[model samples]
Structure formats: C-alpha cells, structure tokens
Target: MKKRAAFLIGTGCVLIAVSASLAVNNQLESLKAEKSAELLTEAFISRTTVFETSVTEMTNEPVPEIIADNEIRGADEQASAKKPIIIDGQEFIGLLSIPSLGVSLPVNNDISYPLLKMTPCRYFGSVDSDSLIIAAHNYNSHFGKIGMLKPGDRVNFTNAGGLIETYAIAEVLTLPGDAVDEMIKPEGWALTLFTCTYSGTERITVRCVKEERI
Candidate 1:
C-alpha cells in the first residue's frame, strides 16, 4: 500500500510541473504579440503621420513645368519659374506620402556618417546620389508594430517642388546593435527607413525600391 501511495504522489507532482510549463509558454507568446503591436503604434505617430502631412501640403505648391516633365533636369530645374514652398525651414514644401505606413510627411536627405538626430528620408540631397535614406526613433509605446511590418509595403516622399515620389518596400531586416551596413548599402536609389527593434537591442531596417518619379 505504501509503494502505491508513493507512486501516486510522484505522478501528481509531474502533472503539476507540466501544467506550469504550459502556462509559462502561453504567457511568453502573448507577451511577444503585445510588444509587436506597441512598436507599430509608436512608428505610426512619429514617422508615418508626419510624412503624410508633409506630402499633402507640398502638393498644393506650383510645380515647375520644366522639371515636372523631366526627371533629370539640370539647367531647366534651376531655371524653372516655380520653386518649392516651405515654412520655418522645418516644413518640407515638396514631399511624398505613403498611405500604407501612415506616413505623409516631408523627406529630407541624411547619410549614416556624422549621424544627426533628425534625418529626412525623402530628398535625394544630390540628384546624383544613391538612395534616399532616413531614420526615426523607435519607441516602445508602438508595441512592436513597426517590427511586424513586412517587405513590399508602399512608401512615398515628395519634394518641395511638388514632385511626387513613390517606392515599394524591398526588405525589412533586424540586426544586432552596432551593425549598420545592410542599412547603409551603396546601391541605387533605395529608400531606407530604420529604427530600434524591441528595446533597441536589434536595429530594424527598411529598404524600398523607387517606383515612380513624378
């Protein structure tokens, strides 16, 4: 009888352990989902909203007929009568807006070297330069929503000249801290957006292919 009792107690202990483990795993999965959502929200507000607003306002600006028809107008662009409009220097008169990312703000030029806090992703800086790269703060309040964003999403940027630019997401990558090349590729004109992923340990990388130049 004693042996049987011992066996029963051992089985009960095993059952309890199994139950606890399952509970823990479920909790972990739930937590990850929550985090992803938070990240998205933060990105939507800071980056996405700002970009969209900038583009919409720029559209109202008069486009130079010379540059409007020609994508690469060296002399005609500068000679055009119309010019990009901006307020406070902080405002971007000509910018593109991406509806998918909830981004409709002005995009400016920024390089990885001598990094600055605010870099606009829209402008190519020099027309001969490579891609239009930009960065934004990755806040936790977003709950990993930005991290959850996948490649192929639509992105837009406009210039003060009322020229609308469009891009399609090419890559969405995450890398360890201090790693910044995949994000800074010297390829053609690729639009790159990056921020911290999950508490800033991993960097979130976004690459986009320039689709339309109007």
Candidate 2:
C-alpha cells in the first residue's frame, strides 16, 4: 500500500510538470504572434499610405480626355486586383479585423504550417471574389476566441489596394478537420474564418456575408 501511494504521488508530479510546461509554451507563442501582428499592421498601413499618395498626385496631374477615359474603364479591374504586400520576405494579402473580438491580424497570401504560426493565412479564394477563407492557429493573440462571435457581428477585410470590405457574421458552426471540400465551397458565404477547436480535432467555422452599405 505504501509503495502504491508513492507511485501515485510521483505520477501526479509528472502530470503537473507537463501541464506547467505546456502553459509556458502557449504563452510564449501568443507573445510571438502579437509581435508579428504589430509588424504586419505597420507595414500594411505604410503601403496603403504610399498608394494613396501616388493616387492623389496622379489625379492632380492634367490628363488627356482619351487617357482619362481609359483609366476610368480600368478602374474596376485595378480595384479588384489582389496585389501582394511583402513584409519580412513574406507575402501578405491584407488585414482582417473582427471588431467584436477586438482582433486584427495581417493575412498572408498563402497558407502553410510555418506561416500559420506567425499570422492568419488565406486558406482559399480572394476577397474580391467574395469567397475568402482564412485560417490561423488558436493562439490567444490570433483566432483563439473567434468561436465567441455571434451572428450579426462585424468583420472587415482591407485588401492590399486599400479597399475595405465589411461582412456580417451569418453563422457559426463546427466542421470536421478533414472536411476540406466543404470548407472551401463558396456556398454563398462571402467570408469564412476558421480555427482549430481547443481539442484540435475539429474546426470552428464562422461564415460571413457581405454587409450592404447604406
């Protein structure tokens, strides 16, 4: 009986140590994500400012009538272009903001294991196409609390070209991690944000639709 008690105490100590170590590691990851987010936000803002300045100067210059007409014709195409914003040697597509969650993070142009560690990445589709899907790790500084969002919550995405698209949450549901086809299927959702559940077995999916501007 005494030997069994000692063994039980030893196992308890091991479990406690493992739990503490995991907590520390999680905290460190969150800190890293926060720093990366700050850097990306600054870069995005700088790029937008420069683009706006150039546009202002161009508009100020006198233009030929025919040239002005051509520019007007291509305006829609230019606005829909997904220009890559490079920061720290990584290509970011734009900034994603969830006002209800008070979360804003730069989304990379492509999704991968390494990139997800730094910030959210575009899992599929484009913002202009109205089928954007984003994925990120469940770090507290990332999409950890997205599951708390409700229908009608506001989410915004600012593209590299300085256009901001607003979306309203339409639904929140869980999908199996292997449901890749369903996750990317437009299905009338203008935007979809997803993160792994706390157990890492399923995805917490937030479906959003474009919010009509008054």
Candidate 3:
C-alpha cells in the first residue's frame, strides 16, 4: 500500500510539472506573437506612407492616354495586380483591424504554421473579390479575443493598395477544425476571421459583411 501511495504521488508531481511547463511555454509564445505583430504593423505603416508619397508625386505628372480595348490588360496582367505586397521577405496582403476587440495586425497573403505565429494570414479569398478569409493563432494579443466581438461590431481591412474596406460583424460560430469546406464558403460572408479554440479542437469563426458607406 505504501509503495502504491508513493507511485501515485510521483505521478501527481509529474503531472503538475508538465502542466506548469505548458503554461509557461504558452505565455512565451503569446509574447513572441505580440512582438512580431507590432513589428509587422510598423512595417506596414512605413510602406503605406511611401506608397502614398509615390501616388502624390505621380498625380503631378501628366496622365497617360488610355489604350484601345484590344490593348487592354490581359487576364494574367489583371491577376498580377492582386499579388501580395512583399515586405521584409514576407508576403502581406493587408492589415486587419477589429475595433471591438481592440486588435489590429498585419495579414499575410498565405497561411502556414510558421506564418500564423508571426501574424494573421489569408486563409481563402481576396479583398477585391469580397470573399476574404483570415486565420490566426489564438494568442492573447492576436485573435484570442475575437470571440468577444458581438454582432454589428466593426471590422476593417486595408488592402495593400490602401483601400480601406469596412465590415460589420454578422455572425459568430464555432466549427470543427476539419470543416474546411464550410469555413471557406463565400456565398454569404464578405470577410471571415477564425482562430482555434483554447482546446484547439474547434475553431471560433466570425463572419462579417461589407458595410456600405454613405
């Protein structure tokens, strides 16, 4: 009986140690994500400033004559216009802001495990198509608090071209992590934001629609 008690105690200690270690590791990861997001936001701001300046200078120059219909841009050229903005060796499509959650982060053009650790990434569509989907880790400084947002809350996406699109939260739901088809469906939503639940078994999905401006 004494031997059994000692064995149980040892197991309890091991469990406690593991739990503590995991908590510490999670905190460190959250901090790292927050720092990365801050740096990316700064870079985005600087890039936007330069772009605006360039546009201003071009406005002073004479406008080029329009080409004939047959000489218009090809499909391939039109697609190239939607390419992601490359910044510091990373491809970013835009910046995402959830005013209700007090969250703003740079959005990468593609999603990967490593990229999610740095900032939110485009999970599905494009801003121009009005079917954008974004995914991010559930770090406290990231999309962790997105679930707190309520219907009618404001969300905004500023594309690389400096076009700001506003959206109003329409719905919030949870779907299984494997519900890829359902999550990416663009039939109704203009923008979708999702993050894994704390348990990582499910996703917290937020759906938003474009807010018409007067």
Candidate 4:
C-alpha cells in the first residue's frame, strides 16, 4: 500500500511539472510575437521619417540644371547674369512631405505641359504671378496619400529665393477638376493640391493655407 501511494505521488508531481513547462513556453512565444510586431511598426515609421527629410532637403536645393541653361539667354545676357546657380537631379523639384500618408515629393513646376516634359514627378509651386496648383499622381506609388490629409496637416516648399515655404491644411474638398475656381477660398497664401479620387478618376483637391514662416 505504501509503494502504491508513493507511485501515485510521483506521477502527480511529473504531470504538474509538464503542465508548468508548457505554460511557460506559450508565454514566451506570445511575448516574442508581440516584440516582432512592435519592431516592424518602428521600422516603417523610421523609413517614412527618413524619406521626408530627404525630400525636404531635395526641395531646398537649387533649381534644376535643365531649367538653368543659359544658352537660351539672349547671347549677351548670359555673360553678366551671375552664373545662374544651376542644379541637377530629381530632388530640385521635390518639396512636400506627408508622413502620415507616406508621401514625400517635390512640389515644383507649374501645371503646364512644358514642365511635365521636365520630369514625371508631382508638380506644384507658382511661376510668375499665381497661387500654386499642386498636382500628384493618383496612383498609390506617388502622392496618392494626399487624399488622407486632414485639417492642420502641413504642406512645404521653397521659394525662388531658397526660402522654405510652409502651409497648413485648413480643409479638404472633394471636387471636380473644373472646380479649380473654388479652391482659392482659403484665408492665406495657399497650396492647392489636386489628384484623382480613390474610388474613381474624378479629381480630389485639397487646399492648404500658408502660415507664419519664412
């Protein structure tokens, strides 16, 4: 009888030990999974942050060499024009960075066909006398995230004098491409962004107002 009792006690202890081990293993696995998810999120945020900084730097850069060609200048003007600072690279036109929506692009050039001939990038920033009309590709690979902008989001670019131009989102409007007349209602200097809507190719335009900045 004593031997039988001893055998039963030993069996109970072994089962308890096995159950405890399994529980610990499961807990460790759960923790590991959570850590992995956290790491992935951090990585994505970091990548976007870096992309924004890079795009902004690109925007702050001088004008593109293609546009700076003095050869076209009336032969005599090129000599005394102060060697027009010439810039090259896609970044010269890059100006805006939307982190929340993972968008960083150069908001340079007018809405004319000739500039589009310069590069296939999203274009904005006024030329001569006009408020900038920003346009981006509706495709997800480009500035499609502009649709995600909300009130208070930021829009940045640089002026002809190499000064950073900043604007804030005051409102978002879902309007037609021809609605261009309605976009200038913002109170301050503004950057009007337009693109095809997510559900359809209909243009989606959002205007951001300029706020105290050099």
TM-score against truth, every candidate:
0.51, 0.84, 0.83, 0.48
Summarize candidate 1's per-residue lDDT along 171-200 as a digit string, tens digits.
777777776565555586467666667567
Q: Is candidate 2 or candidate 3 better by TM-score?
A: 2
Residue-level lDDT for 186 in candidate 2: 52
Report the C-alpha displacement of residue 98, candidate 4, in angstroms. Answer: 2.2
Show model 3 residue runs off by greater than 4 Å: 50-83
The clash count for each model shown is: 32, 0, 0, 4
Candidate 4 lDDT (Cα, 0 to 1): 0.50
When summed lDDT is taken over every stretch of 10 residues in candidate 1, the lowest stretch is 113-122
For candidate 3, the lDDT comes to 0.77
Output the better candidate (2/3) by lDDT: 2
lDDT per model vs. reference:
0.49, 0.78, 0.77, 0.50
State the TM-score for model 3.
0.83
Question: After aligning candidate 4 to the native by TM-score, how far in Å is the CA of 162 from where it should be?
Answer: 4.4
**lDDT of candidate 4 over 1-214, digit per residue (tens):** 9999999999999999999998787466545433432342233224331222333333344334433343455645433221212233222333455545654443333344433322223344352223666665554434456777898876655332233456677777788656645655543445677777865547777777775343
Best by lDDT: 2
TM-score head-to-head 1 vs 2, winner: 2
